[model samples]
Target: MESEALGHTVMDQRQGHGSLVAVAEKLTLEEINSTGAISNFGKPNAPSPAAIVACVPKNVHVDEVGETEFRISPSEITAAIKAGLDFGGAYRC
Candidate 1:
């Protein structure tokens, strides 16, 4: 696997269903959006001034089986909430 090539070990495995778990050394926030952004798409009230969260190192666990799961940090969750609030504020007129 690509993760194995990157020096991550398979901490756990499951049979019957193909699944593996690995730890990522770093991660970043890619995007943020709110319901208003979706509803206002291609409209005048659409949100602008995209909020860019800079890339930062985040340690997280990655579980890949049928679907991908990311075990993220509490700080990451806080950052996401803050970003959502910012997106909502900008989404409103």
Candidate 2:
């Protein structure tokens, strides 16, 4: 549903540039729930660690898993950057 809304916004922007001149003003927390695309489609009540791990590479290296620390493989950083690029919007918030 979040993607659908983004798609609609994109379409609207294409049709009328004036409609979304200030894109930030158009965004709302309601549209970015854990289930929203902004959360990478995660359901509500999910953790940041889990979300971060999801962005890790397929061949991730887990040196240790602790409550406050995570030792992800180098590839994890690459994957996270790729994910950001793939989903980044023109609008800055």
Worst 10 residues of 2 by lDDT: 34-43
List model 2 lDDT by residue over 1-93, tens digit each: 876875744455465666656574767766534324443323346355443434433454445842443456668775765576567632243
- Cα RMSD for candidates in order: 17.5, 13.3
Candidate 1: lDDT of 87? 71
| Candidate 1 pairs with clashing backbones | none
Q: lDDT per model, in order?
A: 0.50, 0.51
Model 1 vs. true fold: TM? 0.24
Q: Show where candidate 1 strays beyond 4 Å.
A: 1-69, 90-93
Q: Write one digit per residue (lDDT tens) for candidate 1, span 22-81.
A: 322232222233434464433468565354345544454445644344465768765785
Per-prediction TM-score: 0.24, 0.24
